[model samples]
Target: MSTTAAPAGSQIAEITSSDASLRRFLAGLPGVDQVGAEARVATLATRSIKTSAKAFALDLAIRMIDLTTLEGQDTPGKVRALCAKAAHPDPADPTCPPVAAICVYPDLVPVAKDALTGSPVHLASVATAFPSGRSSLDVKVRETADAVAAGADEIDMVIDRGAFLAGGYSEVFEEIVAIKRACVSPSGGPNAHLKVILETGELVTYDNVRRASWLAMLAGADFIKTSTGKVSPAATLPVTLVMLEAVRDFREATGRQVGVKPAGGIRTAKDAIRYLVLVNETAGEDWLDPDWFRFGASSLLNDLLMQRTKLRTGRYAGPDYFTLD
Candidate 1:
């Protein structure tokens, strides 16, 4: 629930004033040891929680979920159903906590907004040419502004991977800044939170992932996300560790805290618990809250629900017990 002011324009200008300066700053970032990172997460995955602790971890994971459904065939009926599920993840158990948010395409913002109204569950819309990040800046910004106008509580924008990989760091940086501006509501109320998707699968290396994480944070992204869920090898544990380290160190250096979301390929209660362990081990206990961490998956919620039922009722629920949105 706490908020940190964006870095001053002067501070951003010093590092991003030109392509050469931005390149130098990114180059100065320490390299990531792939083996060490993989080994650390592998070890952490083995640490098991006891009965009581497992129960708590399961609930925490439920609260951290950004229940998402993004598909070309999506319709109002489906989105509304997803919204209902997000607000009350387990209808049979009133004690179950709602998910953190509901993420959908920009065109369906109004449907999700109407469905999620009067609930604490947030409404997130993916913009800036989601999953591909190949569009004009003007178009991207306009889409973002339109989503905000349509009652989106958060904007999940994709970074220009082509520009970033081609060493056009300034181009990617400025796009994020422009989209951040578009998140501000025209009514001048609180700005919609911005979650910048790095799409790490296409970045190709741990060092590049580290650099992109920093660039997104510098450009005023409220949260740095791992993937768009459309790419292969999305949200690997090693990539997430590198991102967690970047956010932890960036806060120390700039005094501004940013959130991390690893979307795609993470399913089941076991996978969720391992990620919670990673956040605790790498970023400390502060990021354990739902505000700082999130899982962007549609099927992950069903698994979490089944696990919770097993823990509470001493038996596993049938897969058909829950609706498949």
Candidate 2:
């Protein structure tokens, strides 16, 4: 519940002691050899959404991303307008909820952090050579520190997925752990929550995704994310399901509540709903809140708003009504 970011050079406070049953569930389970495709997949399909409750939860987790590429001379105008859309939830379509965070690159963190002030919505920045975690450790650390100093509430970093797949898990893990250490806010109170991007498309197999997710969690990842918006695959349900289950497993092991963010290519209410179902069934109710979950999207807000407007007023609101860039 503390707002202060964790300090640099600080050790990742292990969460394994979250709950006894949770640990028991997370402990010494089989590594890839222990799982079977037929098992969870069959159940995964059965639990897919069938009611409004499922749809409602999906809307809550979809966090909007306004890329830096989209912000030019009108950065302030764009940010203010973005905040307004998120703050004023349309009552007509109550189910299409406003986003939890507005994501951007480190340079724009202040712009967004300031715009989101006084609202529950948090400001997140992609740091450490995002979309391509190919940079010096010093640069990554500074990038993270600068973003936090600029008031970013969350740090989303790409996991050197290429290294991990090349059997360099140590490199990937250490970078995340190091970045996590470097992310404390200006107050030096608490470290910004770390979201490690697997760039699942690059990770390839589910086995690799599973391995990367677990490794990042072990090294202090607060959230396991899929793709950098620049990736070809972005976020797919199967890949996301793997990440969500990993969160559940990590929580069970460390008693820590990690969040899940499926970034890239998620643009509609239906796609969001499928992810909601995946989380609800795999992680349960404890993970439902915005603190523990989110969806990375760029074009979802307008669609959600249009639908909400339609559902509420019985009149369709055109695409121009929402400005989610």
Candidate 3:
């Protein structure tokens, strides 16, 4: 909850409104030290959790998951099934908490919305040419509108990493600004929360990850995401650790709260707990909630459920007890 003042006539105020000024503000931020960051993550990853604490972490990880299914062959049936599983992850055990949301492609938003109706599981759609981000700006905005119209509660948009890497920070910033404008209600209020994916795998360095995190936040991202799950090295500990630190710093500098999601390659209960540990130790306890932090993965939920079952039943349930989505 700490905040740094954005004084009048300061760079913070200018960057908060202008693309050119935002570019300079991001560029002027200090570079990240890769070795130091990696070492810190490595150390934090070793923190051990015993019985009750482990059980708490397991359930918390489940609630923070954005159970995702983004495939070329995705169908309505697939989305409906995913929504059911998202709402009641472990049907046998009412103690198992529901996931934060069910993420799907933009086209399947209606299907997911219908399936998730009357449930706490939110329907999130990946819009703006996800995974590749090769579409035009107009197409991106239109797609986002379609998803919102289809009843998507959240919109996850990928930043143009190609443009970002080429030093077209202004273009990238402008695109996010326009997309934020697109995520509006019929009454002109906020419609969907915007998650800007940096696709950290393609960004190439921790410094780039840090810069992209700030860029997305400054551009009005409700959450800064790590990857789109189509890229390799998606959502690594070092990368996510950097993003968590970035949100922590951004909140202090601007007094604005931005969430963080680390998607892809997080398939085990231990891995999910490691991420929660990072959030607690690095981002503080303030971000431990599902609204502030989310894990975007499909398989990770099953692992967490299995572990939850083990905690409740005094035995490991293995993977067979849970339905694979």
After aligning candidate 3 to the native by TM-score, how far in Å is the CA of 231 from where it should be? 0.4
Off by over 4 Å in 1: 1-12
At residue 103, candidate 3 shows an lDDT of 94
Backbone collisions counted per model: 0, 10, 0
lDDT of each: 0.91, 0.68, 0.87
**On residues 223-269, what C-alpha lDDT tens digit does candidate 1 reach at each position?**
99999999998998889998898888778777788999999999999
**Lowest lDDT 10-mer window, candidate 2?**
1-10
**TM-score result, candidate 1:** 0.96
Model 3 misplaced stretches (Cα beyond 4 Å):
1-13, 16-20, 187-190
lDDT of 3 at 150: 82
TM-score of candidate 2 relative to the true fold: 0.80
Residue pairs that clash (backbone atoms under 3 angstroms), model 3: none
The best candidate in terms of TM-score: 1
The best-first sequence of candidates by TM-score reads 1, 3, 2
Worst 10 residues of 1 by lDDT: 1-10
Who is ahead in TM-score, 2 or 3? 3
lDDT score, candidate 2, position 49:
49
lDDT of 2 by residue, 203-302 (tens): 7777677767777887788888888878788888777767777777666555677888887787876666666666777778777777877777768766
